[model samples]
Target: MQKDLIKELCLTQDLIDIAGTGTASQSSTSKWSKENDAQRAVSGKEFKDFAFHTDMETNPWWQVEFEMPVAVEYIIINNRKRSPFDERASELSIVAYDNEDNEKLLHSGTMYFGSEDRGCPLIIPLKGNVSLKKLRITLLKEDYLHLSNISFLISDPLRSFGDKPVFIANRGDGLGERLRALLNSMVLAKEFDGHFIFSWPLSFSKSEFHAIDNPENVFGRDFIDSYLVTRDVLNRCEIKDLRNTMDFISCDNDDYKKIGINLDQNSLKNQIKDKNLQPKNLISEYKLAFEKINFNEGVTEAINLAKSVQLKDKVLGIHLRTGDIVYSDYRYMDRYYNKVVPFYTVESLITRYLEMGYDIVLFSLDSSACRYFKDKYGVVISNDLIPEEYDDIQRAFFDIVLMSRCTEIVGGLSGFAILSSWIGGSKISTYKKILSEEEIKSSFTHSLSENGVLSSGFISPLLKSFSIAHYLQSFKDFSSIIERIELLKKCIEIDNGNNYYRLLLALDYYKEKNFSAADGILLEAVNSTDKSNIKWLAKTKFPKITILSIYTLELEKYASQGSIVAAYVAFLSRYYYDEIDMNIAFYKDFIQKQHNNKNSIDTEFLKEIQEKVNLKAENL
Candidate 1:
């Protein structure tokens, strides 16, 4: 398991063709068209003799055809090594086409050069088992996409748990929250005949993170083949239940029942009420569930490392989450509103722990915050103990597990710290309000035990409103205004507390020239005749003009605090208001400032708006 345990090879030793925009000449007399070139590429050899080369083009392609439909788990591409001038396949995309000419994009990314001259292979793990008759590699950027080797791993459909309900556990949240979610989900999933596939930090996984080149390592070859990443076993396989991070976090049995699974929470609740079920403490209950599940090598290693680092009942843990929150705009509220926790005033808190006979203070913190804590208190930062070569996810996983080893914990507002405190079963003191265990219980759609034991939980009123509002607001396109209004009206019937939802409904009405209805709702939501509200009164072909304007004004006080959608809306609002001079000035400013900073703005919408405003402004 330590070595790169490549699954069984299923690639045929056939001569593939190079034919595309710039591939005609590449097929003649070149290293690409060399006899046995394609065969050598997939023959598990990374030597220059086994490489295939193509000419540079805007869009060059190399394709290989399998004799029959083969289930592809994943593909690895090793670039040719020509040393100094070796321009590796920098940015490329992989596409799979079936016999019927149906195609799907499998993976896309830059082929990063690993350590030394040996370099690293670019691994493209597909989402699930994809049966493709032909596979093609296309260069996204202008370059020759060279290949030293093309290795294919076939999927084993007969793998165990194939019959069980499958859930893809992809947590895009902070590491600690993700682990907490996984623990909760595994508990609920066990209520039904459920299995899970953990795909975290998916496309960004690197060989350096795995280190040692041993497959048995947490991120090693065997670990990846078994769990994580998207592979053929992931493709074409039937998923009885599929939930994203949010869906999994807030899912109930009703959600499952909607997907035709008859797992009912009400039955379980009735059984519990009738004393037909033995009640268990929620924490220990989930602990038992977590015990039943098997974590991948990565998680197991993290837990082991945590155990090794734990002091004998004298460790004090403190988590300072300062990276993203410091830069986060608090004025504009995002979907989930976890209260921000401050760490600057915690010196006294740590001093008390030190005086109370704690031998070690294990500080889990980001790079920016680590220095401050280390210098001020002379404590050990978790990052120093972890290998720097580990990727962000690996580092995050390790940090959380390490924090969980403490006897007592003082945490920030971060779910990372909160979840760690919970896992460690420590006396937790958090700076901000955390999600209550009652809320967690209510968030459950339904729960049932393996032996048909069931417990039903109520959905929070606010959660229900948010869920309906999210679906209704998703139809932001003008073309869907009519359908959107209908849906919003229905949502309002169920939950009318969301003023934002009402504003959306009003915008739809204004778009349809229902001035009376639009004005009524707008005034009710804001109760003002301010200049900002005038845009809502104005007629425009696109409702987004009014909709975006409304959000910008409503969240104007929270202007510094905004989501990507808010920024996008704010950009559109400027254009709709005919602020051409301001638009041009801001665009120039954006270009200048973004030279050093990441452009997190809505560039696509900006471009479209710029083109339209440029035309209109010229006439003015």
Candidate 2:
């Protein structure tokens, strides 16, 4: 039977297990039993014992003999259970016998087990080689051991395999909303599979490591097959290097093969091409899209009504955007505006235009700002017909359509405002000055331009200073204004109503403020019927106030050009209280002269002026 069994084992190429029998109480039926006095016992010369266990006291001992003397470097003991043993294994020992048949112990140590011992079995190294034909068994506890099956696996020495690869997709949390959009493009590129692993920087505890010993916890049942105590490997160089290496590949390099990935470059290029192939890429597309959408019929009717009643030779479309510096912070809580319009910058820009003698048919996004402008600067706004809840994009589209009908545009440095100027086939003007690199790097809070306009590209001082100065000067030049307006009109007409001509117009207007008859002409160019919340002075009240203050001061010199004592006095009275000390005496003397000649001014107007002057003097 033994010979047949050996032949069967040889034929199957499987390891053979020797079972022992004992009495019922101290039964040899346990599969692993120390030899009885009656049973033949092999006196060991030199041998090693490898034990397999299911639990603490349930380990089964095994003895094996080789055909020839072979050196055993390591033993791989497989635990087939789904769970690991609760207690630690006692000992792994190598015993040798001298020529006198005396057993001598060589080496012994406790064997350690991992969290999931069943998944990763223990590998114990042997100290030395021993010559023996047979080995003896000593059964310890049997808590987790199954007496029915026992076997041993032996293998030669090999290098250890490194840890599993960990993949991370690192992106700023502020970009979370746009991540889906960006990922949409990425997914189409076929560079990455849908499966992704998220590794949060924070979310682990040391106590969680002990829970890994449980089969359900370690295996994660159906959820995950593998998990690591991340904190344990937190500072590990291998982990950091792997994460950094992957980040370089996925983000920085943008090269596929360098990071061991295969992708079709042609397909990716085609996808990018498709994005650029949007219908709105053409001028005809803009016209079609605009025409297809039936805009405010009421606004269009109002424009038609205004045109039929009285026509201005020129219509200037004004768009103002108030930006809050605090909103630039990436946190969600502070991203939105506290008010509808940013008043300070808008007011400043508007004041500049008013000084140039521009009749602004302002289209403001801030309703409150529009009222304020009308009350303060007497600027007529045309956006009251539009809805309040329209989002920035929708407002932009509406502004484009409205601006397309305008002769000139005055815009603030905002995406919405700029888009309006771009859409308005008109001469456009902006209030901001380009900064030099040195200027940008300075510590002043007001020096920084919005939306990265300063550092966008290399800009020459001549081009910048001249552009701003020219736009300011243009506001006072009729011929220059006409030329710029005509140039913008031509660009828009030739470019299928493209806004680039308008941007150029704005650039020129921004360079030189020529507030001439073209202001009325520019005002005539817009569709007054299109009402939007943007037309409200409340949207631009603060900026309107600020810009008006600046323009009023700048045009203070021009008020005397008329030499009407009453008009000059009126201008001085309106601006004197706000002017700095440098011009305070000039305004004060002009006011005194007007007051002395009471015949030139109406008695009521003079009394009101005197009252204001007295109030100012009292405050001082």
Candidate 3:
């Protein structure tokens, strides 16, 4: 009778005196004699019992309506017999009908049989709001010919209390892999109650951003809550020439007087005559406490691994990171693999070194790619010896470890790759098509001059260059793109058909508007035997239509400067005409609508050029 009580009812016991008419042989009339029938009274105090004379044709299902308003969060149905029906109960449906004659199907699922006739409970969240007075259950199938006891236990909703925080440990560069290991161990240690810390300089911001999206958006959100960062140890950073990028300020001078963070200790005491320290001082103390925690043992292992793998001269360590940060953008992909180095770039580089009679030990973060190379090219990969547990961390860690072990490293442009190059003291080589500082600063000016016709090829290469520059700035005295170019040249000498690298060189020439040089490199790349998809794009493919459009616009600027010859003007006009004609035809139906038009001026210019060519041809 209690609001949250487990009640059981037996239909046969409840309807003892009331008997249905049936044949003596078919019915259990004698089984319920007068005295026995009297004992089987259907009363509120007694459990209901039911006896069947014959199995019904329609599948037998019992439906119960809640007597009082109840908020049911879980439901359990116990089939009493060892075998309840001919087949197992396949489906269960819970439907609720409102007073207005509208029905809402609340929950539906398959029920699995468990021990103790305790048909596995189906946990449904009857979210805090809503009260239900009626409930119906439909059973699809059962194992036995008969049904037994059906009970309902109802109670209030359960709530979880506490702030779930995600811990992010800042271990600086070279500590990425170790930090990940530490966070992983801590998560396991904390019984996975909260999200573990993540090391920064992560593989990609897009990946990290996706990893920490809204609680309901990510798969692992239930385990993590908030982010954590370590204290800025000025002394350790001073040794490494590393500076903290995050600002940590103390409001009161006296707050960090012991740490020498504030110069005027007395100024804060006199400025705020409160009974206690100011909120700033309190916050500062909290920050200090948060940072001073001991390093996790897992992190210590990562540190040890970094120290153990020293850069010995003979070991040509190559750290290849294959995953892309901006995978969704076709332009970004083109910039990286086409304009930058593709997978074949590394493959060809290693092969070239192998041919040069130098023992090569290559390692990569992308194990799948590494395996493919080993099988296809017969190159010796070093990661085969790594422990399985060590391999369990994310691909970023795998790259860091490989880079730490290498003497000289080469790869596509990546922050993690750059960090590896810095920490390992390894000479680094990357795709040569990077933008200059002047080009980056004048990007806005160029964009305005081009009238919004921006080149993906130009933009992508510049963006990647800036990213690499920013990452390289962290390491002092070792920043030189020329050094990378030298390394790439050596690689080319060893490998005759390094088309990816050749393509990058061509892209660099293209960026400089050295069309002759670009065409020469691209022609060689197209003829090379390196039969990869990336190579194919760099060789035969013209600049992306968007890039061509921008290139023509830049030529128009040159023409406007009175520096363009007749040949130059004709080339620019032809390029613009070709791209505009293709784009216009592609979007002809859409562009017919006034609102769908894109760059009307460029369209009109292309039409004018076409008309002139037609008129000139008629006169000829």
Candidate 4:
């Protein structure tokens, strides 16, 4: 029943690029002002972004000094785009030091120019854990050293993550749901200056994505550990098992609820109110993301495919989602769309664009779409209608990235459609299939009976779950707990296969000290349930409930077959409450006889429990 962790965490939570906050100075500003010119490197300007120039001196350098010692994780040097000079930042040595004499060389490399152009940021990631008071970027060779728009990212200690606002992405669903969850969480985490954890969704969920039919282990550990992150980055933050200790349940979304948790500020017993947190907007964070967020081979191939097409700057990108998403005259709203929407005959819009002498690229998830546009207007159908060679996962990624290549993007009321708009710096818009007033009056509501339209309610699934959670949390008394228990029971009746809601009900019972009720849930969980859910119950709820009465005969069977915790708990229950007057020795002997007497953490823990039972007997 052991589960592998799918850990993909971002480092920029509550951390900022403190480079612009420091005072800038250079060796010599012959071409520009000494004090003012070096400031432009950190000024975050694009048009006339210029670095300080020094008089032809040995090892020309530009340095920034901070008031306090801080950890600088990333240094982005926007090198000049002008030819030959762009590669002049060849021999460079970036160092960090303080007035007390502690100094370390961060990065020493030939800051080479790669494929990315214009806003071509030469990123130097300092992978050391050392902190410094001053950061110095020096050119090793005897020449004028100039770099445009240099930005420094400060990633201070990530010690206090408990009780903070977090967008936990652990939903094991389709790629569309995963992407939408990540996108929404990214936006929310940015707005609240919080964090997002990519957990079991990638690995443990259904593999309807790349390789279908498998549900347990979709993403491999090696796949996750690939270009996504390195061991060095992984070592920085500790993974807190929220199941053991969840101090911060600040969110009220379905993302939290499906995992069996609801936010209750007043109801929480020991919610830490950390003062170190201050809400700050995610500026320059996107630039740092460009430095990080490395893609796998498939994504690289997709990007290359997009580049080959050369959908130039002014080209329009559109996501006309079909398949399960049908856009008839009567139907407009998408199932995953969070807002009220209109259905459009997209051909009319394409015709209008073609008439205006604008080239268009059409992208759709459905096969039947874009025939008229491809034939008449001769607009490029992206990926030749999502290249059949690539698998489901790659196709989705390719389509989104291809659309993102466009300067202006319009996704007409689809989650799959809207995703492309988020990849670039500026967020474009989801293309609405707006109908005229006369057309709207003439349109019938017959599409509401369709499967796709039925699924696309007024709100999103995440929000819908949140609405239920909020309803449960609003009760201010003991009735609140009772109401949650009853509500969850009813929800279980409705969604019987949803072990999460069942677990939530059981946990509510446990919280109320209703051991019998909790035992009831675990008894149900132990049989005819999913293996993961059973394993979860065996680990988290099983041991705790075993003390009540051994609960069921199933426990005895489990105890007989190498269940050390079960055997020990069965012994304790018999010794204290279940069996007639028997000494600790008798029950201990029973446990020793039933279980495979192995040396484990549970075995050691049981030894300590035996000692406690003997002491209680001696006291009696």
Candidate achieving the largest lDDT: 4
What TM-score would candidate 3 get against the native? 0.29
Give me the runs in candidate 4 sitting further than 4 Å from their true place.
Answer: 1-167, 173-177, 183-196, 200-291, 326-344, 385-387, 430-435, 439-620
Candidate 4 lDDT by residue in tens digits, 413-478: 454444455455334554333344333322312212342221234323332232233233322242
**Top model by TM-score, which number?**
1
Better of 1 and 4 by TM-score: 1
- Give the lowest summed-lDDT range of ten residues in model 3: 15-24
Q: Please, what are the lDDT tens digits per residue for candidate 2 over residues 446-511?
A: 212442211123322222222232332333342365565654454344332222223335334434
Q: Global lDDT of each model?
A: 0.48, 0.34, 0.36, 0.49
**Alpha-carbon shift of residue 68 in model 4 (angstroms):** 42
RMSD of 3: 21.3
Q: After superposition on all CA atoms, what RMSD does each candidate show versus the true structure?
A: 19.3, 29.9, 21.3, 22.2
**Residue range 1-620, candidate 1, lDDT tens digits:** 10133422322321111111011122222445565544555444446433666666666767776533455555666666665435556777778887567998887776554212366666666534676667787777766656665656554332334444444444444445445555554554565556544544423233222111222233444434444433323333333433222243234333332221211112123223323222345456545644444545665666567567646668777665444332222111222223223332234445666788775454543444445455656777777887666655556667766776777776645666666665556666763233333332222212112211011122233333343343343224422677777766765665554345566776567567665676466545444343223233322323234434445444322222322223334445566666545545544444343344343333453455457656756876
lDDT of 3: 0.36
The CA-based lDDT of model 2 is what?
0.34
Residues 1-620, candidate 3: write the lDDT tens digits. Answer: 21122322112111111111101111122332333332121111222223221233233333343322334444433332344441344465666544333567876676554322234423344542344445554554432222232333222111011233222333332333333333332432243243333323322333421222221221132232222211221111111100110121223322111121111111223323443423344323322322233433443454456556534455555554433322223222233342233332344455556665544555543455455556655655656645556522332344465564566665555545444554454666753323234433334233324322122222233233323322232222342455434433443454444454554454445455666665556556545565532323322333344322323444434333322121133233343444334333323322233233355543453354455445444554
